[model samples]
Target chain A: MTLASPLAALGRPVLAALAALGRVAIYAGQTFGALFSKPFYTREFLSSLLHVGWLSLPVVGLTAIFTGGALALQIYAGGQRFSAEAVVPQIVAIGMVRELGPVLVGLMIAARVTSSIAAEIATMKVTEQIDALVTLSTNPLKYLTLPRVLAGTLTVPLLVAVGDIIGIMGGFLVATGQLGFNKATYIQNTLDFLEGADVVSSLVKGAVFGFIATLIGCYHGMASGRGAMGVGGATKTAVAAASVLILAANFLLTSVMFGS
Target chain B: MIELANVTKSFGSNHVLRGVNLIVPKGQSMVVIGGSGTGKSVLLKCVLGLVRPDQGLITLDGQDVAKAEREAFLARFGMLFQGGALFDSLKVWENVAFRLLRGPLKRPKAEARAIAIEKLRRVGLVPETADLFPAELSGGMQKRVGLARAIAAEPEIIFFDEPTTGLDPIMAGVINDLIREIVSEMGATAITITHDMTSVRAIADRVAMLHGGVIRWTGPVKEMDVTSDPYVQQFIHGRATGPIAAVR
Candidate 1:
């Protein structure tokens, strides 16, 4: 068989990507319009906060702690190569507070919460429950998407803050115990390196990531195709989209916050 | 009253509905019957504005349904889905009283639960089932719960989409009977879509046979057996070899 030209091989994938992007744009437009329309679901939003935020604390806390510990060790080893081991506590504290904590929490939520929301909503759409909601005079966007998005927006920053504190503590533990740094000095150094700007930047990143995660989940879920296979595909797509967007947004936010 | 005029819907190259027209007067039960993928459900969805018609006008009480104020228009309708789509996260009572518990019609939780339990009882469900999650209920029980929720808000128009698809014959009959009683008692206009002849006979005051993207025959239920339309005869008789191809 003769080999196809490079252009032909790339045509299908490019067209498919453009189609996907168009669909996403449509979903975003619908979601944004519905969010401001009548019959807002405040109770659903509060309940979703409890479900997505309060219930997610334990996992976020554990992940942050372990990540902080590992970062401290790695930073300590790397610093020694340049005779900069004295910078371990400060570097770990600044990194955890400004980047790792929020990014990690956002990725974790994309894996857990985004997948669950997408699967649940996609199943509802496939099974015609969303139609039922429409017949009952309830807007699915108001009833379903608003609550989850509101919950994500409000709760994610709090989770990130909690994660940041826990991570810094983890770094402190490693610095003081394993690396033979004086406990008080390590604590003081970490405190000195961490500024209000770092905390604010992390929270801002958390909010953006949270919005992207829930938006992707809701969009994919609402637009899912028919059957069990459709729901599964939507769940996978939602998580993947949310994770990638979170990382990209993290980089953009970091640049804006510190690159000047 | 609900009316669909020249409604057409298609998914890409597949045409699901082709200028279908139908009318159901106020408080009348209009059962739409057809084989699967014949656009029966799509017709009902078009009227409810769930699936927008490519070319058509849907009117409720002479107001264009497609352009009607959505929330007010929807408030007048209820629906029972094929799968009894109760929220798995909510208690049975909350699912039943979903509308009454929030929005402009918000009521006290206790009062909503009381109404939910009462509606559940009307459908032959026990009060104890109110606190249980949907997953804990049997298939028959879930259908009954769905019926309860459908009637909870006392909507003026109720749409039942395959309300008896998966239940046993006995249970299906029970649901059909319940649907008939509830629609009559509430004096609500009803539109039901089903392939089940039993549901057609039990719940429909007038039956409309949808085939080939349009209504093939429409008349009183008593006339269904005597219809000369080959499509109707083929469909109601479940004949594989007929004027209507079986491949669809």
Candidate 2:
């Protein structure tokens, strides 16, 4: 078969990209409009809380414990090169409270919750359940998206707080047991080094990340194309979008909180 | 009453509903029949305001339904979806009493559950079935539960999208009879979209055939068998040699 010229070869990709971008724009508009609409799904919202909040605690807690332990060891090792080993306690405390805990939990939620939400909603849309909702005098967005979004916004900050404490505790365990640091001294140093600003910043990051994760999931799921293939594509897109947006927002939040 | 005038819906280059116009009188059952991908579901969705038509007017009782108050218009109707569409998280009673337990019609849970059980019983379901989830029900039972939910609020209009698509012949017949009985007893205008001719015979007072994104033939079900419309004849007969092409 003869190959197409370079100009012709570029056309398909360009058109595909534009089409994708157009779909994203439409999804954003639909979600934004739905956000303000009335007859919100209160039952769906409460149910989403059970899904996004209560169901997520164990994983978030486990992740925090391991991450905090690893982080303490890494900080101690790096601090030793400059004879700054004693700084490990302070660094681990500040880092867990201000940065790693919320960011990691946000990323985890983006991976787990965002993908599930996207897949579930996309499947419903593909199967015409969304249409069924409309015909039943229900607004799909109000009945679907708002609840998920609200649950994320409310629960994620609480998750971040739990994760932060667990992470710090992990660091404490590692510092005292494995690193041979004095337990009381390590705890005292951690408490002395951390401030309200660090905790507040982490919680703020949690809220922002939660919003991003749910928004991406809702956006991709609502704009999902037809059939199983469409739902799979939506799940992939939602996870990717949530992950990228979480990281970017983490960076922006960190800078705004600490750069000053 | 519902009327669609010159309604058109297109997806990019694919025109799904092409200037389709039809009318359903008040408190009557109308079945729209067509093969898959022929825009039968799309037409129902347009009338339900799920899909916005590119051009035309949809009116209910002389009021412009397409531009009507969304909530007010939607509250007037109920829909039984193709796959039942019950929420998996809710028990059978919760699903049936969905409207009664929430929003504008919020009732006490006990009261709603009682009504739900009553409605479930009306659909030939046992009271014990109310405690089960949608996932626990068989396909036929799930359809019955959906029918119960549709009639729970005694809607003025009801839309049934493929109400018998996945059921056995016996179950399908049961559902068709239930739909017919419910619509007539409640004096509700009913619109059903299906490819099943048996369903059309059992549930529809009038039959409209959709082909190539438009209404090909629309008249009383009594007239459908005798109509000279090639599309309807080929469709109802399941023939491959007429204007309709066989699936490759």
Best by DockQ: 1
TM for every model, in the order presented, reads 0.95, 0.93
User: Which ranges in model 2 have alpha carbons more than 4 Å from their true place?
Assistant: A1-40
Tens-digit lDDT string for candidate 2 (A1-260): 24667767798889986887687667556766876867677768888899888899999999999999999999999999999989988998888888898899999899889999999989888877777677666777788888898889889999999999999999989989999999989989999998988899989999988878887898789878888899999999899978988998899888888988
lDDT of 2 by residue, B1-248 (tens): 89999999999999999999999999999999999999987888888888889999999999998679877788888989888988776799998998887667778999999999999998999999999998899999999999999999889999999999989999999999999999999999999999999999999999999888889899999999999989899989888898888862
| lDDT at residue B91 of model 2 (Cα atoms) | 94
Candidate 1: misplaced stretches above 4 Å?
Answer: A1-38
Instruction: At residue A249, give the lDDT of candidate 2.
Output: 87
lDDT string for model 1 (A1-260, tens) is 24676777788889997898788777667767877777778878888898789988999999999999999999999999999989988888889989999999999889888998899999999977788777766778888998898789889999999999999889888888899999989888888888999999989988888877888898889989999999999999999989988998999998999989
Clashing pairs in 1: none
Worst 10 residues of 1 chain A by lDDT: A1-10
CA lDDT of A227 in candidate 1? 95
lDDT of 1 by residue, B1-248 (tens): 78888999999999999989888989899999988888887887788788889998888899998778887888888888888988887899999999898766779999999999999999999899999999999999998999899899999999898999989999999999999999999999999999999999999999998888988889999999998988888888989999988785
Please estimate how well model 1 matches the true structure, expressed as its whole-model Cα lDDT. Answer: 0.89
Task: Report the first chain's TM-score for all candidates.
Answer: 0.93, 0.88
